[model samples]
Target: MTAPGSIEPTDLSPLAWRLLRIAAGYEQRAVERELDDILQAHISMLESGSRALSNRRRQTLLELYAAELSPEQVTAIVEHF
Candidate 1:
């Protein structure tokens, strides 16, 4: 049994990141410009679940997308990690 408000194991899929990014109206090039260290190819790989994001990168993305995401979406993404 899972606790209330906790993320399910299946919710940890990288697709959440991709969905949130799209919902926030960012394309790969825009995300790359926002995250200087990451290239468009890397963003593509991350969205495709072929790459893993470090904690720092995740935090950066959270901050970047916060303004665009709903409170519930933000909470879900935060819990996903």
Candidate 2:
């Protein structure tokens, strides 16, 4: 078992991405605007597991959500996902 507040290494699933965005205080529309290339519909598809997250998008999300998540957690996500 891991210590308190530590994240377990695991795949960065669509649901996990959604949760991270929500936890970071961003609405889907806001994230869509930030991503520029991605539309709200595409964001919805990504969160719903109907679309795959490209590496570029994943890196963007990591940057976007960095403030809300710890560096260690982000590293774990990047390494294991």
Using lDDT as the measure, the top candidate is: 1
lDDT of 1 by residue, 1-81 (tens): 333234332344577777778778999899989888878887787778897777667666656766687667766654664
lDDT of 2 by residue, 20-49 (tens): 777677888988888777777877887798
TM-score list, all predictions? 0.70, 0.66
Error in Å for residue 25 of model 1: 0.6
RMSD of 1: 4.9
In candidate 1 the C-alpha lDDT for residue 14 amounts to: 73
lDDT of each: 0.68, 0.66
Error of 2 at 55 (Å): 1.3
lDDT of 1: 0.68
